[model samples]
Structure formats: structure tokens, C-alpha cells
Target: MLTENVHIAVPTAFSEDESLHIQGTIDHIRSLYEQGVKSVLVSGTTGEQHSLNLQEKMELINGLEQEEELMDNMEIIFGVSSIRQKEAEELAERIRPTKLAGIMLGYPPYVRPTQEEALIYSEKIIQLSNKPAILYNNPNRTGFDLSAESIIQISKIDLVVGIKDAGSKEKVEHIKSDTHRNDLHFYAGGEEELEEKVLHGYDRLSSIAGNISPAKISQWFEKMLKQQKVTTQESEEIEAIMGQVYQGNAIVNVKKILNQQGIPMGICRSPIGNV
Candidate 1:
């Protein structure tokens, strides 16, 4: 269930303290697609979407849809996270006008609950949207861990096709092992290189590093997909450079590396607070 292309997920693009030029966001995504990104996700945590107001989020999604270039081959997945179900559903409905490919949702202050509560939340989103759904389970940020059983149960609905696995190795293994034969697809989040989840056997990868280091990141991702291993030296350089600040938050280092290579990734929306 590999729902995205280019195998990278750039989370937290705009920091709260920073100023976001609406045109800047669209240009950034368009540039990535031209660089060979098959799919691009907007308004996720990486996009700093939670920090945006409801109207702002709508504007962003609508803007992307209007891009004739984006409407062609690139798949754009909009983040649908909200403090309440009604607001979330409203966002989903708003997305109907755009050709948004998918919607991703995770925990929020207003909807914290046990697995059953989460299941209901997921169902409501699926029924409300025409686009596919991505269930984000980054417990470190979301507070409550979304159980694999919860995901599997919810995934029974056709819309919930993918899960962003941001849990620890043990948790990931359980879900991967459990869903070995299911229709549910697992999306590897964060530092895919550091974790080696791709090396260990996950076929699909979602790298934030891909933002700035499109060519290099794509090379490694393609290599990994092909079962080819980069030298420890090559891998180490990537990690040391991208594993820290100034690139795009945790991903800024990666952006720095890319900037060195001649890409136009200006800045990470600025201040980079709490990336």
C-alpha cells in the first residue's frame, strides 16, 4: 500500500514564529515535483499545518489544486487534523473541490481517546471525504499511541489505506508483522536512513530529507528499493549532515546539504521553533 511517490515525507515546513508567503509554499512543492517527486503531501505536521487557522489551511489546499502543474501527475495529500470532528469534516468537504489525492489525520487535544474513540474518529473522516485517508500514528507527538489493532480494524474501511508508522521499532515490527498480508500500507516516517527500516525490509519510505536532498535522497531511496547498499561512508555523510538543525528543523540539515548541491529551498518558514 505505497500511497505516495518519491519516498519522502517533509513534516513541519512552517514554524509558528515564522512568516509564510503563500506563493513560497506552492513554488517549493512545484520545484520538488519537477525534481522528480511523484507525490507531495501538504499541511501535515511537517508542513506546520496544525499551526494554521482553518481558513488558511483551506487556502493552501485550494491554491495547490489551482496549480495546473500539480493537477497533472503529482498527488497532493492535505492534512485534515482539527481540534473537533465537525471542523475536521468541514476541512474534508472543502477538499472535495480540489482534486486532493488524500487526507492525513492524527491525535489532537479535543479528540484524545482510547482505541475505540479513535476508531470512531477515523470512521467519521472516511465517510466524510472522497479522497483516501492516511492514519498518522506518531505517538511521541500525538500523546496516545494508535494500536495496530486499532488501525487494522479501521483499515477495514476502504478509505483508510495507509498508516504513518512513527512508533518505536518494537511497535513498528508488531504492526508490520501483523499486517504482513493485509491491504493496509505502512509509510516509514522521520529519519529513514538512521533507522534502517528500509534496509531491514520496509519497501516503502517517506523521507523528510528528500525535501532538500531530492537527487541524493532519491538515489539512496532508489538504491535501497533495489536492494543496493550505499557505503557506510556515504550513509554516514548523509546522517551527520541532515540529522540536525538549520536545514528544515530536524530536516534542515538535509536542506542545507541540498542547498549546497544547488536546490532552491529558501528557508524552513523561519525560527524553526519546536521542529
Candidate 2:
């Protein structure tokens, strides 16, 4: 079982020429590990996984494999999603034998498959990876919403452990009431409106802001989960951090902040940071 309550969705590093910089990515992850961060999600939306080709992703995975300390010590979850099901399947298979902790299985963007098709896609990837799965459903981005019925059905699969951005409070409650599983975790996608999310039964965090302020964000989230009050000073600090991360494009802002800190996160792949 994936045990981390919070995981940083890290950005993939790109060179000046916009090439994948595998070492740079690993270096940032190493920095987080050194800072007492126990888990991270690579190649998710923050990692710009859609911008990376299969070959580059394979290279990145291989690079992570070589980092024995990080691989062995952290619950390093990888993101697996592609417009093509075959590509996602292949990627899942590649991760099947890896030291990777688990997967953030996102719905395919643009194609917007039907509920049945989406369920099939989810099951196939979950089967191939044979790892704990956190189903990611972003209707705004993917234009395909996984209904509560679908969520309940998918949650029955033992490999399926959780769901990210699983929708509003009512939907989450519905799923909770309908599903028989006791271990399913509800992960708020980012730090935005997080207090409300936690109140609404979001028990886990796939954190974007944590990339920049891992300890602070994690601590703040822990307090929220515990129903503890955040001091005024801490609240102000979190507001500042949220502004830095959520202003403009979040991925771009995070890369810039990380680069300033000397982690060599580089720039977002073209079009994104293309000023």
C-alpha cells in the first residue's frame, strides 16, 4: 500500500534547447529527499508528461533507476497517461518491474472516451502495472469526467487505492457511501481551496505547491487534516507560497522558483514557458 499522505508532483527538467534533462530532474528529487520529503510523483501534469515522448520518459525512468538511494528510500510514484492506450499500457509495463512505488493513472486528454472505455483503460493499466493505483480524473483538462458510479466500480479493484480530484463534496460522499472499500483515499489535486477539500473528505494530497515548499506545505496540510488551527503567521506564509505557485502558469512558476534555488529544474517545454 502507498502510505504517504502527501506527495509532490515534480516537474521534468528540460535543457536550454528544450531537451529532456534527466539528471536535472533527478537532482531536484534528490534535493527534496534531503529535505525530508518521503514521496514524489514524477511525469504528472506538473512534470509535463504530455510534452514528453515515450523514449524520453523511458530515459527518465532509467535515470531514476540508477539513483539507488532515492529509489529505495522514497515512495516515488510515476504518472502514466497518454492519448493512445497502447502507449499508456507500454509505459505501465515498463514500470511493472521498477522500484517505483505506484502510479497516478490519469484519464487520456482530448479523446474523452466513454465511461465503459475509461473503465477498460483504467483496469488494463492497473492490471499491467500491478501496483497501487491512484485514479486521476480531471474533467476540465481531459473533458471526460469519471462518474461516481464508475469511481465506485473501479474502487473495487484491489490494486486501485485512491482517486485524485474526484469531484465535489456531494460526489465524494456518494462514492464513500456506495463503495465497500475502507482504504480508498481521496486526493485533492493541488493546494487550491485545500482546507475546504479536506473538510469535504479529501484525505490525501497530490501537491503542486509542495514542489517549492515541501516541509511548509506538508506541515500546513497535516494541520488541516488534523483539524488544527493554522497560526496567522503560518497562514500568511502559505498565502505567499500559494501566490508564487498558483500565479500565472503553476508549472512555469515552480520551475523558475526551483531554478532560482539552484536545483536546475530548467524551463517548461516550449509553448508553456515560451515568452
| Cα lDDT listed for each candidate | 0.66, 0.93
For each candidate, what TM-score against the reference? 0.81, 0.98
RMSD of each: 3.7, 0.9
Model 1 TM-score is: 0.81
- In model 2, the Cα lDDT at residue 52 comes to 87
**Inter-residue clash pairs, candidate 2:** none
In model 1, which runs have C-alpha deviations exceeding 4 angstroms? 1-20, 109-111, 176-182, 192-195, 199-201, 240-248, 251-275
Worst 10 residues of 2 by lDDT: 44-53
lDDT of 2 by residue, 15-113 (tens): 999999999999999999999999999997673878888888899999999999999999999999999999999999999999999999998888889
Model 1 C-alpha lDDT per residue in residues 207-270, reported as the tens digit of each score:
6766766677667666767777799887886775465533445645654544465544445654
Report the number of clashing residue pairs per model.
11, 0
RMSD of 1: 3.7
Deviation from native of the Cα of residue 19 in model 2, angstroms: 0.7
Residue 15 of model 2 has an lDDT of 92
